[model samples]
Target: MKRGKKYVEAAKAIDRGTLYDVAEAVSLVKKTAVAKFDETIEAHIRTGCDGRHADQQIRGAVVLPHGTGKKVRILVFAKDAKADEAKAAGADYVGGEELIPKIQNENWFEFDVVVATPDMMGVVGRLGRVLGPKGLMPNPKAGTVTMDVTKAIQDIKAGKIEYRLDKTNIIHVPVGKASFTEEQLTDNFQTLIDAINKARPSAVKGQFLKSVTLTSTMGPGVKINPIKVM
Candidate 1:
């Protein structure tokens, strides 16, 4: 694809079945493809139960310095004090009870993340059926619900990227634009990997550093050697 040429080229340079291999494969194929492997871009062998099942599993999170290069629309659920705080903090959408019915009737998803205050959880809870499936639900575990509306809105605007394991226990997200320099892209990649390493779930026994690959939107993927990074 137009966005993946650089990642494809980088993968070709590795000349090994690193995480880059999956990236390269994805880049080369015309249709979207999924990669499964026992090693990470760093070439570290995955250990333990190998939660590679395409269902329940825990992965990690990453905060992309450059953000996802996509504009994030935030929906804040608050009233009075919190509502004012969100508006002052630059929230794209902020309201209370009325907002829920409007969203339900419109089925709008242009927004990326949703934030709600503790007091407003009951109202927001009513929209679980609508927001949960879209992964836009406001949950305390993901830091999407807080009393500090200012900080919540600031973090969303600051390029905070949340990652979770897919059905295959692998986390995927875009790190940069195609126009970004290799150095810039690599730095972003390293930052994400470090975060993932730090988030290793205790349930995952043994070597937690598994396989990793870097690819772009509709581009070839390249696997990086984990050892070189270790």
Candidate 2:
């Protein structure tokens, strides 16, 4: 768990006890990105909900206003017209069960996102044991499992990202890159926060957002004021 010198230097810039405003946090994240390569900016939101409870689970997707800077490769699980639609909409790869072997035997996973048509879920189910753990398994709640292959592919290509609470109820997502303007990063951050707020489950009685932190790929986390975000 030894951090590099660059990371240690960057960590010194942030006040460990302070909760920064969204804009300030975004700016601090950009400033602390000392890596030679344009590092990706990520948001980590700790929520009060417990993922073990079905009713408290938080899972959904949102189209970042200033899309995630990384290019998203989409793998569509479809057949016939739907498959064609997916390709026409700029899907990186489109196929049905035939892909199972390529993925299983060859260990091929070139795509960043997985989209499957509702009818094709049966075929997709076979790969669940592999895809589920990787967070590649498409679900209806995330709009990855749907009949609208074209829309799904387009959205993903347009910087749409899915966010869901992990085992500890923290949702980690890429907001943008360090190369982006502070304004762009702020916009994407706000959009994501708004979406998460709207998705709050009625079952949660205490604070919905426990803590929100923004940081670059190799930088120290800058905590955001949860009250300000809410």
Indicate which candidate wins on lDDT: 2
| Backbone-clash count (model 2) | 0
Scored against the true structure, residue 184 in model 1 reaches a CA lDDT of: 51
User: What tens digits encode model 2's per-residue C-alpha lDDT throughout 66-148?
Assistant: 88988888999999999999989999899999999999889899999999998999999999888898999999999999999
lDDT of 1 by residue, 142-188 (tens): 67889998987887787676666544455666665555444555566
Off by over 4 Å in 1: 1-62, 227-230
Per-model TM-score, in order, reads 0.74, 0.98
Q: Which regions of candidate 2 fall more than 4 Å away from where they truly are?
A: none
The TM-score obtained by model 1 is 0.74
Residue 136 in candidate 1, Cα distance off native in Å:
0.7
What overall lDDT, based on C-alpha atoms, would model 2 receive against the true structure? 0.93
